[model samples]
Target: MWTTGKVIERIDWNEKLFSLRIKTDVEPFIAGQFIKLSQMRDDKRVARAYSLVNPPGCDYVEVLAVAVEDGQLSPDLKALNPGDSIEVTPKAAGFMTLDEVPKGALQGKHLWFFATGTAVGPFISMLATDEPWQRFEKVVLVYGVRLGEDLAYLDTIKQFIEQHPQQFVFIPIVTREDYPEGLSCRIPDGISSGLIEQKAGLGINAEHSQVMICGNPGMITDAQTALVEKGLVKNLRRAPGQITVEKYW
Candidate 1:
């Protein structure tokens, strides 16, 4: 289930975030799915799940990760270089895939994606694909970070926004370091407080909307509770609902 791939590129997304582009011949994966990557440590296989940042079927699998200072995997991941061998699990994982969430237009609903930190990985893949734009009347992506420096994929998201203009919305939320552009607040606060909807001009209604959340445990829990209070429920394979979650951290 695990295969070795060379790190084709190592990106310094920011001081806090770094990424790896692994060239592999694995099966195609869904946009919001994740893969386990590992390296040998103390004679044991140490792995961590990382959401794929690129669209499915790309020649390279891209993973966006926030370097956890003094953490188990961060040291090794950050130390990777081009041509460095990394153990990549071939089987893609995670329920964050779009197939598990609610559809739009046909179902008369909107789709919202909330992400923070490196959690932006999966959302970027989803937004790049044609399925979302075709299925949703409107799609809003709320990306939250601690400071303006943490803002990422601006060009990529901007290009997608330009192409879809009317149907896709991109909002960045920064909780620290006063930024004149992006709204400043926690993602759940932005939603429960209505500031995010106000900026997008499209209300997030539990009745006619489905939300996908990916981030740290705290953010995911808070956002889920807020959405549930608004009449949304977590989608299950046996019992479908209006919300889906995948903890990226």
Candidate 2:
């Protein structure tokens, strides 16, 4: 059912990217789950699923989104200011949480998160919690965007690095322009070329890596193909494997 949500805060990352922190009655949810935001438009309901960026125990829900050109709802969302009301799902939903990863023997030592664009939101939510730090020896985040200006949440990421210097790695990839702190290739190309692993100083294989990829469909497909070539398999509930993915679009 739909619940009324008030926009309590907003953060403009760039002209196109922004974050909305909403106060609502949405039930507690897992870190990586998503909630649908909706509005009534000309007698029709326009809704979109956005992954919750805030960690699970928060009193509010936060989502990172980009205003897609000519999108049905995002442009309107972009125009919203604090105190504006929107409709939200009362309960968040999705199966991309860390709980899905296998435990004990199959649970690898390194947890890798691959994200592009606003898909990094869910990963950020997961990282804010203690589960990953307690469970894995190493955690890595590979975030890719179109340009340097498109990267978001740098300060939060920096905090993670400071808190876990030896155990965390962040690889930024900017494809269209120079990003001295990151790579110039697309995510799949980086993996295929070994540049990503070279930066992490750790190789991905079936035994030691648990990878969760969330991003544009094209990136997810190509990245998964590259990982599969490296012996990692798709993670499924029935048959646990190494790679897990959520396509943002």
Candidate 3:
């Protein structure tokens, strides 16, 4: 289940965020899946899982990666150029896809996707799929970053919202920058102060909402606790679902 892909393009979406387009020979995959890339250095094998950002039916595979200071894979990946070959594992794995969601719960419900940093990966995948767009009456994405520059994929999300204005909502929250348009605070602060509800026009209650949380472990824990306090339960495969979470650290 391994293949080699050539780097076709590198786009600096922001100062710290970049998108890589790799030409692969494999068929398409579910939007929420990920690929494992291998880089050999010093005769040691190092690999990392990166969620795909390209739409489900695209001809090339696109992945958005953040440069972690002194990170093993990020530094090398950041330097990749077109015509370079990288090892790509074919079988993508993760439980964050729509198939893992409870069948009837997601249909005709409001979906609130909250993410921080690179954890926005899976949500990007889901948003590109027909299942989410066709099922949910409202799709609200709340992405929290350190600053305005860290808000990668803002334009992409805006494009999605622009394409389907009746169905999608994108709310960007910046903790470090004083941006005039986005929520000017942390995600938890927004939740506690009813800023989230006020902006999205939806309460935190589980009756009309389903939430997917992806971020650092601390942020996920705090967000889950805050949501639970508001009476939302964690969704599981064996049980009816309400919230799905993916931890970054």
Candidate 4:
């Protein structure tokens, strides 16, 4: 299940975060799924899993990555240039997919999407498809990062707003930087303090909507607990609940 792809495009957002678009005849994958990519480091082959940034139906596959200080994989991954070839796993897999979201949840209510940092990848993937906008009457996507500059996918949000026009809302939260346009607190605070619900004008409830959370383990854990206090249960295969979550590290 290995394929070779060329780096068709590359973007350096900042010193820490970067973006890559790979050109390959990759198989179609569900939004919210991830691909395994391998690169050579210290003469040893190392593989890591990265959530695909492109939505379904796209010809090219995109990925967002954060560089580590002298990370074994980062040096090679970051050095990718146009026409550079890399190894990619043929199959993509993950459970944070929207397909797992119960049909009953999106029939006519709002769907809450929460993520921090690069965890936003899966949500972007989900939004690229027609299922969310077609089914849910309204959608709320909340993305959290440390600084305003760290926020990615402004173009994606712009495209969504232009296409849907108020059908969906994106809230960017920065804990350290306070831009008047973005919230300056953690996402859980936004939920508990009633800011997220108030801004969206829809209070989250088990009967009316469902929640999906993705981010670092700390954020996911804290958000899950907070949402539970608000009457949302963590969704499971056997015992379905109101919230579905994926941890980014």
> Using TM-score as the measure, which candidate wins?
2
Regions of model 1 farther than 4 Å from truth: 103-106
lDDT by residue for model 4 (34-145), tens: 9977887678888888899899888888888888887767667888889999898877889998788877633337788999988898888889899899878788889899
Model 2: which residue pairs collide? none
Task: List the global CA lDDT of all models.
Answer: 0.85, 0.95, 0.81, 0.85
Query: Which has the higher TM-score value, candidate number 2 or candidate number 4?
Result: 2
Clash tally, candidates in order: 0, 0, 0, 0
Q: How far is candidate 4 from the true structure (C-alpha RMSD, Å)?
A: 1.4
Model 3 residue 94 CA deviation (Å) reads 0.5
- As a whole number from 0 to 100, the lDDT of residue 33 in candidate 2 is 99
Worst ten in a row by lDDT for model 4 = 101-110
Tell me the lDDT of model 2 at 219: 96
Listed in order, each prediction's TM-score against the native is: 0.95, 0.99, 0.94, 0.95
In angstroms, give how far residue 166 of model 4 lies from its true place. Answer: 2.9
Superposed by TM-score, candidate 2 places the C-alpha of residue 96 at a distance from the truth, in angstroms, of 1.0
- lDDT per residue for candidate 2 within 1-249, as digits (tens), equals 999999999999999999999999989899999999999999999999999999998989999999989999999999999999999999999988999998899998999999999999999999999999999999999999999989999999999999999999999999999989999999999999999999999999899999999999999999999999999999998999999999898
The TM-score, computed over Cα atoms with residue i paired to residue i, of candidate 2 is 0.99
Question: In model 2, what is the error at residue 194, expressed in angstroms?
Answer: 0.7
Q: Any idea what lDDT model 4 has?
A: 0.85
Q: Model 4, 110: alpha-carbon shift in Å?
A: 0.9
